[model samples]
Target: MKTFKLNPYRIGFRTIKTAAGMAIGVIIAKQLGVINFSSAAILVVLCVKNTKMKSMQAAWARFASCLMGLIFASLVFELLGYYPVVLGLIVLLFIPATVVIGTQEGVVTACVIILHCFNSKGVSLDFILNEILLIIIGLSIALLLNLFMPNRSRELEDYKTNIEQEFQLILSEFSEALKYVDIKLDHRMIAHVQLTIEKAKSVAFMDVENHFGRNDNSYYHYFTMRGEQALLLYRMVGLINNVSRSDQLHQQLSELIHEMSQNISGHDHTAIRLHDLYAIQLQLKDHQLPTSYEAFHSRASAFQLLHELENYLHIKSKFGSLKK
Candidate 1:
């Protein structure tokens, strides 16, 4: 559910690659000359996949823009024939008209119209009509191709991987913060940690929606549990304890993670659930849990680890990739 400015450079490069490939292939296929509009339809197909909500918006825009361009081109060709004056007039109108179209939809349409008219001597109605027809054919093919294609589900696995990595990172960060107990933390570091955790939680939820979706019957309960665990970590962020107990808790947390990683396969889900006393053991190297903020942080670190485990399990369950 997050939107940000699209990376224009990346998008532009991708567009160029696609257009070049399409044009080359079309040129090679000039024998049939059937793919002109159809191959160009890729622009719309890819545009839709950019975001779920934006999927159709770009495609529709392209279609409408092309329609307008086609109409304009057709009128000019019919009335002006291929005369230089007529050609120049169409050129004069095309740029301003395209600018006003103001979307990819318009741009695609304009491109199609321009391409169709480029080899013409006069405003050729047949040329314009052919482009229009090809655009329709191309769009239909593109839409159907996209519709049948399966979207990647790697995001679900990535969600689990990211959470696992974050747990390690959070602890690494927490471990560092502890080392600097005497040194005040830079506000920037704290801000970074906070931002990471916030984004992690949001991404985890979104992962569930996109990949480990609830429509799958088994995942319903798993998603619920995962959400609950995220909440637990959010609340525990307020309850960290950094004291003599820190060292001991750290050891215990490490052991907990080791044990939890074993359960990644979920081959025996009940086996994991039945294990009791997953608490941290061992006293700190020499200290008890520290006071106040230290204690909260110590406890928070452990809680967050558990929270990540909770989310991971849900992903496994939803995806049904768990070995056991």
Candidate 2:
């Protein structure tokens, strides 16, 4: 079992936004003389999200559901005289109605409106308008705060740089392993890089969500490309591990790998590398046929390793062209 630790100093931007928005929203609502003004803070807390799209979604759902809740509460309470059982009956009907309307995310905010209606002496136009004003005030403040989303480009670039560095190191290590068959490749490094790519993908997705009008997803696609290439690397490691002996082809491939490691980056240089790789392939094909069975196995493994490396380069090539 893992123990949970709470760090007091680790505050997130979303947390700061929620706290500040709550205070500002409630103050504005109170100044506007809206009833249940403090509930404006609750709305702010509920609507604030890590991304602008999500905050907008929550605000819309809350507004739509609260409107429906007002209709339900006004009719039910006005006819039934705001009895406790009647309030219970409203909950039973309101929740399902919210789900039916696809505004279940607003259930809590809508219930707050319903409770306000129940607390009033009677359903009057003034009180209904007041609740509506509160909704507008709360959701407006949330949207306003969300308009200031922190730019994630730098953070995403960092992830990209880190992933490229990891790839460079992995390739360099693989180059060493090719030259010396006894040098065991660390599989964990590949796993860690894949995990980092996944994390970076999620951040990229959130970044896309934050930008309402922008549609470019180059960052997301970049991480996806790296993830695919990481799988190729993992497969190449397995192929390298299977080789029982090193030969001239192994040395050539190692040199190619070292060259690739030096050039590893976000930019596309796949065409040149592919050309070099194919030249090596030709050399292997025309080289003296493996004289022994063990030699044949080693040569076969090298070919398979080259094939995986080719696919890896092709992945980046396609991604680079698409980026352009």
Candidate 3:
């Protein structure tokens, strides 16, 4: 038999925020003298989300559905009589109604409101106002708490640093692989770089979602640029690993890649790199035709590698221009 153990240190900021938000919502609702004041806490629990847009969306859906639910319940229950069967009918009809209106996120909350309506025995303006107040109190507290999410920019920056370092290491390895055919590239490191970029992109996207008013996010753009470069790097790795032997051209490209690896960062060095790449391309054009099939294949791979490198720099160049 396996025993389950909880890692107490696993609690995160969201947990803390939710707990505090629930308490505040309940207290405020009770102070407002609203019936079923604790439902406000439930609303807070349901509405808080990892991103501001999601939280806002949940809150809006819940609020809208709750209102619609109340209206549907008040009419159907008052007219059809508040029987248990009537309650069931309301749940049946109201769910589909909410779905039709695209407020399905609030279906649970709406059901809660329906129960309140059923228990009231009759629908009155005062009763409807009370439910509205409860929703406002709960959802407002949730939105407020969600607004205090910890800044993830620092974490994103750390991911950026890790990704750049990994790229540097990978490129340095590529340079070595060029000079020595027997050198084996670390597939594990390549995998790690891909994983890191994905994680960073996730964080960057979350950062973008956190800012409701901002149309542009630099971190997102940075990760996107890195993601494109990573694809190029993966292709280059395969090409470099297949190179038959080192020659003057191969050595020159290797030296250039080494320099590029040294300068990998958020800064724009694409213009300089592109100039050097063009020089290398020009040199490639001046070389005599390969006499052997292996030499031809190697030269072909070198040309592809050079093209990939040029594209990699162009991606950064475009990104830099956009940033300006």
Candidate 4:
């Protein structure tokens, strides 16, 4: 809320900067008695658009765009203004149309140019000056309103939570992905893999964007951790896919998953089912005994290994070690 209220003023300040342009405009406009208020109002957005370089980029972009627009608009409108109503309305319409420009620089420049076109008259020299004064008023109001808004950091945290939840949603799809693969290991399997991969990458990007402001090391570390977690899931899926397609289920892969699941679900190491999965993997790999997925499924093991693995993997990735 505070940022919201202050945002308007910041925008106005940007506008005022453009209109005044090193204090000369403000001094001259105030002195000449041709000051305008909206000048500063538009500059704020230009600065905001360049906020990627930590607000400095925005400031420069805003000022440069605004000034260039003003210069161009002033010249064009001067020639066209012989027909005041048509020229004035056209200029007015053009100014606001720039509102949807989607970038700070574009919007600010458009704003200034439009203002020049709309307000230009015998007071061409005073146009920028007048705008500079109006900028102060708009900025001040925005500043005052935004003074006590809610904590922006907290809002960022909420966004972070949402991103994490979206990541989890991808994780939840894994079992479905597996079951689908079990039915037919076709191109559809690749589609699920791509979806999960993209979703994980997006989560990593969001975390990077929202986690650290300018501190590079911490930001990299956080993202690196997330990448590691994502890779683990990728590894797990690869293991499961192999089981579904292999002529004979691979023993090591099955044993690893079986042990990992037991570790995940907090199931007893001695549980009959967990032991049986290990035994099944060993027997199948060696062609020693029972030779089917159905036989493995029919046994009433003490705990479901796959379920335990999924839950544990999710918990470990999203949170800290469950061992604690």
Per-model TM against the reference: 0.45, 0.92, 0.92, 0.41
Each candidate: RMSD: 10.0, 2.3, 2.1, 11.7
* lDDT tens digits by residue: candidate 3, 1-324: 999998768788888888998999889989889999999989999998998988999999999999999888999998999899999999998888888989999999989999999898988999999999999999998899889878997898799889889899899999989988789775677778888999888888888889989866898888888888988898887788766664457888898899899888644576788889898887776777888888888888888999999999888887774341
lDDT of 1: 0.48
Candidate 4 Cα outliers beyond 4 Å, as residue runs: 1-59, 76-104, 133-251, 258-324
RMSD of 3: 2.1
**Of models 1 and 2, which has the larger lDDT?**
2
For 267-300, candidate 1 gives per-residue lDDT tens digits of: 4662453242232222333445456775656665
Candidate 4 lDDT over 98-181, as tens digits, reads 445533445544565555556555436666554444444333333333222223344334434443444454444443444444
User: How many residue pairs clash in all the candidates, one count each?
Assistant: 31, 0, 0, 19
Local distance difference test scores for all models: 0.48, 0.88, 0.87, 0.43
TM-score of 2: 0.92
Residue range 12-117, candidate 2, lDDT tens digits: 8888899999999989998887878999999999999889999999999999999999989999998888899999999999999989989999999999999999
